[model samples]
Target chain A: MAQPIISFNNVSKRYPGGREALSNINFTVEAGEFVLLTGHSGAGKSTLLKLIPAIERASSGTILVNGQSISTLSGRGIPYLRRNLGLVFQDQKLLFDRSVFDNVILPMLVTGQSHAESTRRVRAALDKVGLLDRERANPVALSGGEQQRLCIARAIVNRPTILIADEPTASLDDEYADAIMEMFRSFNQVGVTVLIATHDRDLIAHSSPRVVHLQRGRVLDKATA
Target chain B: MNALIRHHLHSLRQSGVRFASAPFAALANMVVIGVVLALPLGMYLLVSNVQSLASSIPTEPQISVFLTPGAAKTDVAALENRLRAVEHVRSVRFVSREAALASLKRSPGMADVISTLRENPLPDAYVVTLGEGSAAAAERLESELKGVPGIAHVQVDSAWVRRIDALLSLGRSAVILLSALLSLALVAVTFNTIRLQILTQREEIEVSKLIGATDAYVRRPFFYWGGLLGASGGLCALLLVFLAQVLLNRNLSEFGNLYGVELRLQFLPVADAALFLAFAALLGWVGTYLSVSRHLSKIQPR
Candidate 1:
């Protein structure tokens, strides 16, 4: 009925020097849907996730995010496009120079949120990710799991409609990975569209969400739960 | 609008904190800018002071009409009236040969030289002052007075003033050239400083960009940092110039005592100092803009 929150029609990405990261990929995720993008290393998982935020442009075909064509979006329009997205990178990408709270507050700061509102939202996001007590600690002091959780806190602090994370549980223990998956589940239950890229077959097998599998830059299957 | 103001204020504080974090490095860069700016500013003040001193001396350009030895008193009186009637001629004073001889003898060492001369070799003259003080105007009046029947020679007696005027003009030009060159150097210093800052924070910038930071949002702090550096350097240059004035004036007072005149170098005026600071800040802003625009585009997140 309503427009899909994200739609990719024959989307393809070819990096410089002739390496095709994504080839004729097509998918659509409706609002409030939880979809998993699973592939092995160099299987275009990161590239596919990066395309949604306009970090990487499609070499062919079009991608529409929240009803706007990202293929032809201007440079000035990219930031506004990204503001509606909450992205968590595989590397955590947490700024070590600042405290955990500051790292989590960056998205709000970039969108020009008020100081009082930003503080309240930052604390709430940290609390949701179980980092409220460590807000004042430097990100460099965070453990791998805490740092990963910090990235999620930062990503969700802006209350973006679409939450996309790339390999969020890649470097964590099973318990921490399960906890992170639960956190994503809780966010998904509240009407946020969630798209996660991961290679953990067992995690996907145990989960009941729809799965889009990629192999050699092509979507191998779109298996519904 | 409130959010914009808040963002600017936040950027300003961040720049200030960055400067404070590396005081020695920041001070070194600012000192380099100060020294470069001080060279031209100090030269400007010196030239201006010399110009004022030259003006303080009696520099009214005048033309002298000397009569031939056989000219009668009535001829001299008629010539004075003719000179006064000329266009742009303000006034004419008649000096008799005997009065000139008397005034010459009034000098400390000229009486003996006058006594050695034969019966008054000095001729009566008319001192013609013009409304215009230009050298060309004085020469024109001199030629006109020379055409008169009783006048033997007409001399424009403002040569020293013209020489000083030419020298001051040259000084002003030199100051302008030096200021332009040093201003370029100041901008270069700020450019390099901002470039290094951008490089060191490359990761932070990439992260910020990925997190929806606009180019303007990312550039605000660097702009503030550059402006602060420039303003601080300008202040340092002003202080350096003022110290130089004080040191030079202290020595000048002793030197002036020998010449029986009070000579002191003046510091830059408040308005001029304020303008200098503003100019420095503008230069800093320009440098930051260049550095950020050139480097920011190359740092997109992978």
Candidate 2:
């Protein structure tokens, strides 16, 4: 009954020099839904996720996130928009120069949260991601799966309503990947909207959430759970 | 409001940490800025000190009017009255040839030379002191007195003072030009230093931006770094200038002994020192702004 939390209507994205990343895409994500974007490499999953945050502009059509048009957002508005959205990249963009705690505390710092509140929330987020004990360790000392979890801690530290992750479980053993998926599941159970992009069919098969499949730059199917 | 203050304090602490992490590089940069700033500051102090010394000297312009050898006593008296009647002439004193000879004989070495002379070789003279100390006014009076009757020559004694005034003016201009050039150099040093820092922290910047850090938020630490660097540089320059003053005064006291005057270079005034530090900090802020605005936009998280 309520307006969809994210609605993409006939959206298209064409990079410079004439390479189309997404075409005529249409989707609507409810406020508390968990959706999986499954597509092979170079299938525009990353590009589609980037569009929600206005990292890449849409070539045509409109994307409304929380009822605000992404196409009309100004440069100054992008940061505020990103503040409400948690994003995890495929490469685990963690700052190795600082402690794991500091890396996790960046979003709070950016939003100018009070130091006491930020520390409490950061510790709570770290605990949620099972990294509370390793807060003082440098990110460089983290294993690949722990690094992925650290990135998730940073992403969710601000308590963003929408969580968008690209290849969050890539290059991990099944045990680590299952642990990460279980973390996302727990967050989703708490009513945070989760959107994940991955090409792993086995991971997709194990999940019971709605699945949006993409082939090349077009949406192949949207399967309701 | 508390959060904003905390954020600013955190940014400032981060800048301080950066300098602490690389102490040697930071020291070298501050020293470079100090030496560059000191060049003009030192020149400024030297010029001001010289001007003060020149002012301390007696500046009352006087003209010496020499009478002809055959001038009568009445002629000498008439000339003195005439000098007193001149506009801006404060006072006049007449020195007779006998009085001049008597004064010369009182000299330790000049008495023997004067005793051998048959008559006083000196001509009568009138010493005219002007109320206005300007060289132009003295020169105008000198020319007018030179054409008067029973007057052989009129010499303006303030010519050397005018020459010193001109030299001091030139020195002031040199100080301004050097200050302009060295201030530019200070900005350049800050710009380059910030550029290198931005490069080293490229990844951090990208990640910060991706997580919703505004341009101002990203720039806050670098701005603090630059401002601290410049403030420290200004303090270092003040120290350098003060040390130089002490050393120069040590040598100048001996030099002053030869001239029988107390010559000591004074340190920069408190107001001037504070203004210099503020100016250096502003330059650093400008450099950091330029470096951040130019380079920050180019780095977008891919």
Model 1 misses residue B176 by how many Å?
1.6
Model 2 agreement with the true structure over A116-158: per-residue lDDT tens digits: 8999999999999999999999989989999999999999999
lDDT for each residue of candidate 2 in B158-178, tens digit (9 for 90 to 100)? 777778889999999999999
Question: For candidate 1, what is the DockQ-based docking class?
Answer: medium
Clashing pairs in model 1? none
Give, for candidate 2 chain B, the lowest lDDT window spanning 10 residues: B128-137
Cα-based lDDT at residue B211, candidate 2: 90
The root-mean-square deviation over C-alpha atoms between each candidate and the true structure, in angstroms, is 3.4, 3.0
First chain TM-score for all predictions: 0.97, 0.97
Quote each prediction's TM-score.
Answer: 0.90, 0.93
Name the best candidate (by TM-score).
Answer: 2
List the candidate 2 regions with Cα displacement exceeding 4 Å: A222-225, B58-60, B67-70, B93-125, B131-134, B147-149
Fnat score for model 1: 0.65
Query: Per-model C-alpha lDDT, please?
Result: 0.89, 0.89
